[model samples]
Target: MKYDTIIIGAGMSGLAAGVRLAYYEKKVCILERHTTIGGLNSFYRLRDRNYDVGLHAVTNYAAPGTRTGPMAKLLKQLRLRWDDFDLSPQVCSSVVFPGHKIEFANNHGEFIEAVCAEFPQQADGFRKLVKHIEEFDELDLSQEAVSGRKVLGEFLSDRLLIDMLFCPLMFYGSAIPNDMDFSQFVIMYKSIFVQGFARPFAGVRQILRTLTRHYKQLGGELKLRQGVQEILTKNGKAVGVRLDDGTEIEADNVLSSAGIVETHRLCGTSLPTPEPAYGELSFNEVIFVLDRQPQDIGHNETIVFYNNTEDFIYAPPEAPIDTRSGIICSPNNFKYVDSQQLEEGFIRITALANPQYWMSIPDEEYYPAKQHWCDQMAAAAVEHIPDFRPHIVDTDIFTPRTIKKYTGHLNGAVYGAPHKILDGTTGVENLFICGTDQGFLGIVGSMLSGITIANNHLLR
Candidate 1:
């Protein structure tokens, strides 16, 4: 039977979109190339320990019954409850630069107070910037691109404070190098500083499982390990898809979370615009299992975005990994309800990586390279937080190569194309894009991208 929609990539957006369509009583099938779901945020086991692929924290946090913000909107649209996500708000996180540091929690007031206290001279300007963000409609799809850096300059005169504010937001969501669209800046600002960070006790696995289960219950067909090799198009319309094994299925519409450049290649259809340039930035994720909780080692921050110098260079590094700056996170540091905790102590550090260098490294030297950089990464991190190196027992490293292999992202661009297709429209009549390239970010934003695309384009 012909399906009402065939969604590609069982990542957050694809699964969410499938659920949205199926809930409307449409016939939907979600196909994944990987053996499991959660393309970029899946989980795995190593030496009897669990590891999450891309989750640092679920941004845009909200309480159990809030009726506003992205968190509440997501649950309301998906017909889910807050307990479904099981998010615990972060304890506190900080952005540390040499001779300067500011801390913030879920409370936006604390962040404002910290900024004002830290940069007394820029307090008034900073408040004005906050007002600008509050008034901006970041979710407007038809908005033209505007440089965040330039817009920030119009509000504040302090370069350090501007870079500091941009640090965490860019690290978590920016696809562009050393810059972002103004709308993206507002969205990231509100999500991280205004709404804040949180995580489920079970990491990414819990969220993925929740989405998959809901989709299935709504009569959405999910086929894992069923990779789509190509888009079957007819007269500028998406007819269906051809599986990697050469099986063909027909559908009335197709939605892809596989990213813009990748999807363009798959479509093989004549389009109105040239294929967009994919992003260059990627990361080296270093996970260290410690012998004790991070708090025991005197490190209590949930996540620390540290830059060794004041410049905060945001680009692909010339070296294997950029040790000058990185993020250090301890999952055990979140304010979990009932004082519950994970079974193991974990410290994660993420550094900007040279994607070309990591992807082209000799296989024989890859493992050794990971170890060598892991040491450097930790060395840089210890300067910001207490040295927990002595407590480390096991380490896991994943680079751009691993990302490309799993998600099929061009250059393993974690945030997909630098330019976002906000309207989810491709040149093909019924084929659209979602996920990273669709412009929303993180777990909440990615899921919201799918839902928005489905509601605006598919359902209507």
Candidate 2:
């Protein structure tokens, strides 16, 4: 097969790339090893129930009539209407510590009010922080690097509040937990805080469907279950790709969303340089299918970012996750359905997990270890989430191994490689990188990365 561009992986980035190239009337082909789409942001069904995997909510929602943020531009470029996405704004989310709790409303003013209420002394500093973020441009790499801790320290003297502010941002966005770069911290803060979050009425599946339908309508070719074995290159430039079954498909250029390290491995020849550290962070996630509504069990919040410790450490613990620092998301709350109106509720809890630790466990001890952690996480969750123990009708657990198997990430690293910024260039001419590796954090960011590369690098 021959095409103008061949994109590997049918994730959001790959799909978005295909859509843009195809919209310009170019021949684009998207190949996926898995039968479904969305990569990490995909869904599955078990016993006639749908379970969403990759989203707590689509962060950084761009409301209708305002083509402002990244999400807005993406929809406008794709010719998709805002009505296509059924979105519900979150009621509120809280960051809780030992003696203090800060709840944030969807409105920016309300959120700022809540923050200022806790630390009135830093109120002026908080306004300055916003002004700085608004004026700062993360795309400008000429500026010196700044750490998130340093930025927070400049504004607030209270150490606990700094940790509290970063707890959710680190979990939701940061790959470098100990100290996330200030640029990344700024970008995440803009996306999550400035733009705010909203749940799609139909969940992630609807977003995938919209992208796939648009791509197909624009004459893009989508090949599922077709794995690319090698990226064919000659004279240090990408030419095409070879499928797992040895079928070679030629393209003018190749775009890979399989991640930087993973894509490098697909090159048959040994590059004359050392590869950067690939897999950095991974997560241990649990999905709980409750028998009753979330509000019925007294867990009324849509999402809560809670921690047991006064100081937050983003990395995985040496032992089990007993610290009780994690995100609790109630998917049902997105629709604003009351306890009496809702049927069942879905809650997903995520924790930073050591991929190496899980990989070293012997085959005989794997399931036992998983059971122990599951029990511990559930027990710890009850302290924050009401009726967590008794209301669990069913449960599903996914380890780093499972993530590796599905996503082809070396360590099941949630965010591909550390310090992977935009430009999508991977030192190999004509082969560009996108998705998490391109430095955009959430779902909207990934799609924007795809569009950025397609227009800036490819179409240019």
Using lDDT as the measure, which candidate wins?
Answer: 1
lDDT of 1: 0.93
TM-score, candidate number 1: 0.99
Mark the regions of model 2 whose C-alpha exceeds 4 Å error after superposition. Answer: 141-144, 270-273, 320-322, 335-342
Tell me the tens digit of each residue's lDDT in model 2 across 28-80. Answer: 99999887888878888888878777888888766667757777888887788
What TM-score against the true fold does each predicted structure earn?
Answer: 0.99, 0.95
Cand. 2 Cα-lDDT? 0.80
lDDT of 1 by residue, 149-225 (tens): 99999989989999999999999999999999999999999999999999999999989999999999999999999
Model 1 segments beyond 4 Å from truth? none
Instruction: Using TM-score, give the best candidate's number.
Output: 1
Q: Distance from true position, residue 298, model 2, in Å?
A: 1.8
